[model samples]
Target chain A: MYENKRLGLLYCLPFVIGVALFKLFPFAMSFALSFTQFDLIEPPKYIGLENYREMMTTDKLFPKSLGVTLMFVALTVPLRLAAALMVAQVLNFKLKGINFFRSAFYLPSILGGSIAVSILWRFVFAKNGLVNQAMTALGAEPIMWLGDENYSMWTIVTLNVWQFGSSMVIFLAALQNVPTSLYEAAAMDGAGKTTVFFRITVPLITPVIFFNLIMQTVHAFQEFNGPYMVTEGGPLHSTYLLSLYIYDQSFKLFNLGYGTALSWVLFALVATLSAVAFYSSKYWVYYAGEKERS
Target chain B: MMSSLIRSMVAMGVIALALGSTVVSGQELRFSWWGGGERHEAFLKAIKLFEAKNPGVKIKAEYTGFQGYQERLTTQIAGKSEPDIMQVNWAWVSAFSKSGDGFYDLRKSASVMKLNEFTDNDLALGTINGKLNAVPVGFAARMFFWNKGALDKAGVAIPKTWDEMFAAGKALRAKAGTKAYLIDGEGYDMILMSHAYVYQKYGTPYVDPKTGKIAMSAAALKEWASIYKRFQDEHVATPLPLRASLGGVEKPTEQQPDWVAGNWTGNYTWDSVIRLRGSTLPGKGSELDVGDFLTLPGAKNSGVFGRPVHMYAVSKRSKHPEIGAKFIDFMMTDPEAIRVLDLSRGIPSTAIAFKQLLKEDRLRPLEVKAYARIATLNRNNAITPPAAQFEHPRMQKFMREVFEQVGYGKINADEAAKMLNEQGSTILQRL
Candidate 1:
């Protein structure tokens, strides 16, 4: 046991050092910077809560950006989870060329955040892009996908949903782990397919769905590259998310202190939502050995 | 596990070898600039030539696209890791040069550049606090560009004044049955042009020279916003929805392809963009023509006309300061390099380099004509410096927002004027 503990310590030393140096240090530094005025050049000067206070009261764009980001998260998270689950269910069936389909769907998620994909997104949603071409073919007026403020947000949301392959893969793995005996017992009991699915498969995969939901919601809140490359937060700033606003303030405008404050505010929001989700998970999420009590 | 350890050892060995090569005996100078692919190729070739000439000096070139050039340079400057030599924008000269000891004074070094070969105006642009902190390489001024075939098809004459331009746009739209904006006024150029016209008419620049305060009068703001509002209301411009989708400046022109297909008219752009777009358009090269710069109707005597294009500065932290200065000298004085660059860095400001390229028959014909016209006009006009607010990103964003508000019809001329007055002044004061 002592030898095993020594081996474990040796293996974990690198990881512990890495976490302390890369993650914890930066997190603590940014937390401290939230209350300071530092332009990344001069030494930082503490200004109490002035940065946060200004963001709350004086910054007109902050509330609007926060609202837009929340709306995006609200719409995209549920739709993406549903689509991913549906696709995973379809793939779980025994079919020809199923692996190829799964791989093709998963490819976009891997490339989603890349510059090449962002450029492709711009071309796909341009005024006279493929979307409009299809619309015109359908005997409808060509809608400006990226130009109008009303439609631009949908383009970003659709981009987010289109990269649901990662979550779908997770769902597929969870589905595979579901025991076959449960389905056999349901069949023996003369339950319909829908009832079997609802009572057995979905309940078994509830933990996976819960996991994917929280992860994707956090990711959606930080979506930046799509709107930045496609519309540049334009059409009268309708598509401006809090992430893009923070990036503009920090990098483009050189307001590092204010940007850090915004980041901390975002952290607080994400943490609160995650905490709520975790607290509520006990009611709905099911584990492998859990009783089927109400 | 043994193979993994061996692989790690090999990686460390390679990195150590790379680091060992960095410690060369000769003085090494690192230079960075933002440019397109062609400019990068030309610059690399010039660096090779410089290396051949200076046996003891070595240069490392770093280049990137212009999209985030300023932000990257500012970060490098802040980190105190800026390259030995940097190709800087003229607007950023104040921002970088204000750090008194953060930039090298080129005039004090014996082996540094001699500014005598450059023009008086070029030298004047590089002088800050009576010290030459940078070297001017080129000059570019905003001018009107037109698609001759489109204009001819629409049966409209090129306008020489603001009123005539508006009338011409309306006539073109009617005849073409499509939008016919004279120019898509984007970014600071539009604001600068508007300010010039207003300053000429009122006989006052945007800044008061005596007090060093912003003079963004409510009347001027209203006038500027009204012009844009009129452009939208008259069906002369494509609606806000269409214009907002157009991508970055370096991207290919959306309207140009349509203009070639006989759907739209001209745009206002730099000469380089005009040439680049014209080359790609599916028409005879002569179909595109350059238009003369227009003046507001009441501002014919506008003295606000000059623009600083781009400049080169040496970093204060450079180990090889003389090598950096030499690179700047080559950028300013080398005739072959100038011809190879050829309006990619704008027109050469040095008289000798300009004459050498002209003699070599390497100058683009349209650029030559354009430069000649600007020179003739510049001889009689006063060259006003760029506003201090131009360097502030907040001010740039505010200007863009004001345009957006006007374009979308969310606000009227008076409201935009009010917003501009309040926000613009606040931004200027903060800066």
Candidate 2:
């Protein structure tokens, strides 16, 4: 048994080493660096809460970026989850060549965070791009999807919602696990499809919904690539999310300490929101065997 | 069981040994740069030639497009794992080498490098704290280039002065319609444009390098911001909203649809990138023509912003600084390397390379014209070498934001100018 344990330890060594070196080390270092002023080329000088003080008082963009990030989260999370659930409902149906549709829907998520896809998204929403061309063909005046402050947020939100395949796949799996007997019983009671979905389907899939909400919320808070590549937080900074601000401070300005401090604030916000979601899940989320166990 | 344990231990040892041996052997040096395709190809050919001539020395080339290059270099520098040689920006000398110890001093390698080939003025541009930190690749100044076809269609001549340019803008709009503007520019261009205008009229730089403070007074700054506001209001340049709507603020003007189609016609840009900027115009590059330097009436200075295009620097952390220095010398002074490099990286700054290229008649006609104009400007001392702090990324962004606020009517010129002086001074002090 000891020999067998040693073999198992050997097998896990590479992964253990990788996680400690790459992930854990950086995680600790970033936390330590938050209290200091460290330009990339120079040694860090301990400043002790000065970075936080500046963020609240001196940094003009911090509050605005936080507000914008909150709005982005509020917009993207629901829209993306709804899109995922809607697509999952249709894809859950056992139709011929259903796998192809599943793959096609998943394609965007695979390519979503890449710079090339972001560039393509920018061109797609551009003034003389395909969407505007189509609008002109249909006798509608072209909307400045990426240009106007009122509409720029929607472009990034739409891009996020369009890449809803991962959440959709998870929802699909949850849907398949829902007992068919519950649906049949609802149908016998003369429940309409809408009633059945609300009564039988939604309750059984609440756990998955709860899971997806936490994930998408966290992801939306930390969104960088979409705003970075697309609008670049412009048109009066309507799309200037906190993640983009953090990146600009850290990488572009080389204010590593202040950026790390901002990152911690973002992490704290995400953790609190996630904890609230987990606590609220007991009321709304129903597991299959949760009642039985109780 | 014992044999199996021994075998596993041996295997782990072998793997560790393999990983440890990954470092390159012998006299190999890493060199990194960022450029467009033509520059990359020319550099690669030159490197190949250098290697053939100097047997057993290997240069590992690392190159990328312009985007994200600075961030990558910064990270490498922080880790103390930078390449032996690097292509650095002129503004980066102070930022990277504040005390003059950040890079390998070229003066130390004067025996290996042909330091005498370059002029003192050119060398001084890269010197920090009396240390020759980098070698200037070439000199570039912002100049006007107009689309002759578009100007002709609008029945307007290239404007030689500020008033004429504004009049021409009005005339072009009247003839060509609202979609047609006199110039297409991003926020940075607007900052430079206003700087040139303000400096020519008021004879003050935006920042006083000697004192390290905001040199433009509140009234001067007000005029600076007001002129940009006027540029937008008068259709002399594209409105901030229109430019933002068209593409990213950082996107090259030449790539904009309106610019390509001849609706957005003129640009005040670096002379170095004239070929790249003009190659995609409507008339297969024939439509482009250099315009006279715009000046205001009663101007005290020309306000032509000129500086080194870029520089080649040897890393102080490099193990083979002498070899890197030698390579830089070859690129700057070798006849064979010069013929291969051509004018891809602008006109060479070194006396030997510049005179040779001109004598060989290898320079393209358009560049020759640009060089001649810049030469004339330099001879008269109309061109001022910009303070390095003026090109700091943060400072540039602050100016752009101030210009943008005025352009968007979010703030008046007085308020914007106050921000420029007050807030801009704070930023400069921190730097």
lDDT of 2 by residue, A1-294 (tens): 998888788788889999999999999999999999988888999999999999999988899899899999999999999999999999999999999999999999999988898899889988878888999999999988777888889888888888899999999999999888988888899999999889888988998999999999988998988998889997788899989888878877778899999999999999999999998888788877665535
lDDT of the candidates, in the order given:
0.76, 0.87
True contacts kept of each: 0.48, 0.56
The numbered model that scores best in DockQ is: 2
Off by over 4 Å in 2: A292-294, B1-23
Please give the lDDT score for candidate 1.
Answer: 0.76
Winning candidate number (TM-score): 2
B-chain TM-score, every candidate? 0.88, 0.95
In order, what is each prediction's RMSD in angstroms? 3.4, 1.9
Worst 10 residues of 2 chain A by lDDT: A285-294
How much is the lDDT of residue A235 in candidate 2? 71
Docking class of 2: medium
Clashing pairs in 2: none
Comparing to the true complex, what docking class would candidate 1 get? medium
